[model samples]
Target: MKKINPHTGILVALAVIACWFASLFFLLNWHFNWSNPLVYLMVFVQMHLYTGLFITAHDAMHGTISPNKKANNFIGYLVVFLYAGFFYNRLYAKHHQHHHHVHTEKDPDFAPHGFWKWYFSFMLNYVTIIQLVIMAIAYNLLKIWVDEKNLLLFWVLPSLLSTFQLFYFGTYLPHKGEHDNEYHSTTLQKNHFIAFITCYFFGYHLEHHQKPGMPWWQLYKVKE
Candidate 1:
């Protein structure tokens, strides 16, 4: 695999971080009309931005976000913290374990059962008590100033929904069935638009596992 310019990854990561916060701020302050379709549209839009946060952090974990280790890890920590108060070092360790172990029992990202079962196992490995406490504290504090409904609909729900979007596209589909390939993962049919919307081009799962150093934005290049 060809090495991507490290600055490209840095720019994308920063852009994603900016977008996530901007969208969250806008939605949290927006006046709502549940009857309007646009209100619903904003929900999914925010959801995708949430997924982008994780993808940016995921790239940082791979050292794709910056050549400097400290810079890369800082971005990773910031995004995960913003996303859901997740611990970056815990995620970083587990993610590398997933890569090394692939679809085996040792892989924290994998499970042998169906979608729900696998999702539970996956969440158990990543979600922590500290994360819950942080989120709970943030929610209560933010709601004192922000609209509770907006926080629930835009901030809270979107983050939860984004988890399913990511798990379905990035984990369950790719690693569910038996794979004969070396990566033990599968790819979606080549459609970059669908790929991006689905999980930031992570539906190209084999390409990702094959070239672990590639950033989310450049995964389509690996496909080509």
Candidate 2:
């Protein structure tokens, strides 16, 4: 069995959720100041938080968030919904398919096309009309109280950018090229800080595929 701090997943989940909401609240209330460097910084900050939200949900899908199935799934459902109106059950099934079929045609995440084509195909797997409708509804409702600019820049834009951040570091790079390894996955050079900053250690893609039970925070320990 893989050694792990069972408490870490839930704790990290709570931290990511709390930070996402807090940053969103602050940004929604904030006056826009392009002249201010903090305005720019906060975009990246919120983008990272958005990625963190998905990472939390991903961990939950693996049942790493808690030993209790209900708690684990609850956290998964919560974070994915918070991320972008994603359905936990839908993602759960698709993700398992991803693992089982991997890079094969049956894999929901597999796209043999170039980056842009692959990205759109990847987005299609999870992005639904329902999600778009939910986002539209939420935007209209929230804009009544919040500035539209702040909502777009801080909320919508960051979330969109985070998709690129996630797809590039986590999916595109790791699985783009052929690999001789059993998992058919590529990992980054062993730089723990780079791994974490890139995608919460998801850059260690081969290690993750090998030990799907391991949580994101613990990937570095196993990188060796």
Candidate number of the best TM-score: 1
Full-model lDDT, candidate 1: 0.92
Instruction: Write down the lDDT of every candidate, Cα atoms only.
Output: 0.92, 0.91
Candidate 2 lDDT by residue in tens digits, 94-147: 998989988999988889999999999999999999999998998899989999
- TM values, all candidates: 0.97, 0.97
Judging by lDDT against the true structure, name the best candidate: 1
The runs of at least 3 residues in candidate 1 whose Cα sits more than 4 Å from the true structure, single-residue gaps closed, are: 1-3
Clashes of 2: 0
Predicted structure 2: lDDT: 0.91
